[model samples]
Target: MSQIPKIPRRIVTGIKNGRSVITDDAIATNVSEHFPGLIISDIWATSQMPADLSTEIIVENTAFPVVPANGSYFRYVSIPPDKDLGIKPLEAGQVHPLMHKTATLDYIIILSGEIYMILDEEETLLKAGDIVIQRGTNHAWSNRSDTHCIQLAVLLAAN
Candidate 1:
C-alpha cells in the first residue's frame, strides 16, 4: 500500500496576472535532466497543482488525468484504503518480475520505506529519493521493510 505525501499547495500566478505562462516546452529540458537520481524539492508539484491536490498522498479513491499538451501534470489512482497491496516480503535473495507497459514513461520514487525494483530482470534497492526510470520495461516493486512501503509515481506524457 502507498500513502501520498501531504504537500502544501501554492497559488498559481501567471494565469491571472496576464504574465507569461510557464509552458511545457520551457520545462521539457528540465524533465529530461530531472529524473533518475534527481532530488527535487517536495515543493515541486505545489507550484503547479492546487494545495488540495498537491499532496503526494495517493489513494485508490482518487483518479485524476494529466494533460501534457500545454504542460505536464500528475494524476494518481490510489489504492483502496481498506485493502492492502498484499506486498510480499522481499528477501535478500529474491528476484521479482512485474509486467511492462509499452506506452508510458513512469518515474517511481521511494518515500518512507524501501523497496527493490525488478527492472529488466535486474534487482535494485531503492530508498528515499531514489528514482527509477521505466520505459517499455518490465518491473516490479518488492518491499523489504516491515512497514508499508510508500512510493510516489509521476508520469510524463508526450507533448
Candidate 2:
C-alpha cells in the first residue's frame, strides 16, 4: 500500500505581549484515513463565532465531531481515484455510497488534481484552483482521474 502524503504545514498567528506573532508553525497531526486511500487532516477548529483570540490556541489531536455545532472546521482531504476504491460512476437514480449531507456551509478549494462534485441529480468536474460553495446538501466527491485529488475545505456551522 502507498503512504498518504502529509498535509501542508500550518502557521497560526496570534497576539503575544500585545503584538501579533507567529504562535504555532507545524504540520497538523490530527489526520485520519477513513478509507483505503482516502485521507483527511483536521487542521484547525473554533468552538464559536468571533473566535476567541485572547488565549494561546492549541489544536488537540482528539477525535472531533465531523460538524461542530455552532462553530467552524478547517481540514484538508486527499481523495483517491474511484477506480482504486472499486467505485463506479453514478448512474441515473443512483446514489454514491459516500453521498451524505451536513448542516454546515462548506467552502472547498481544489488544491491539486481534479475531482467530480456529485450532487443528488447532477455532477460537475472541478480542477485545481476551482472553488465550490457547498451549502448544506447531499453530495459526494468522486475522483475519476488516475491521480489523487487534494482539497482544502472550511466548513461553517449553518442552520
Please write out the lDDT profile of model 2 over residues 44-82, one tens digit for every residue.
Answer: 887788776654334444322365577788878888898
Model 2: pairs clashing at backbone N, Cα or C within 3 Å: none
| TM-score between candidate 1 and the true structure | 0.45
Per-residue lDDT tens digits of candidate 1, residues 87-159?
4454566544233443446676665666666665577877777877766466665555544445566664532
lDDT of 2: 0.80
Worst 10-residue lDDT window, candidate 2? 56-65
lDDT of each: 0.42, 0.80
Model 2 lDDT at residue 70: 72
lDDT of 2 at 34: 76
Residue 138 deviation, candidate 2, in Å? 0.4
**Displacement of the residue 39 alpha carbon in candidate 2, Å:** 1.2
List the RMSD of every prediction in angstroms: 11.2, 2.6
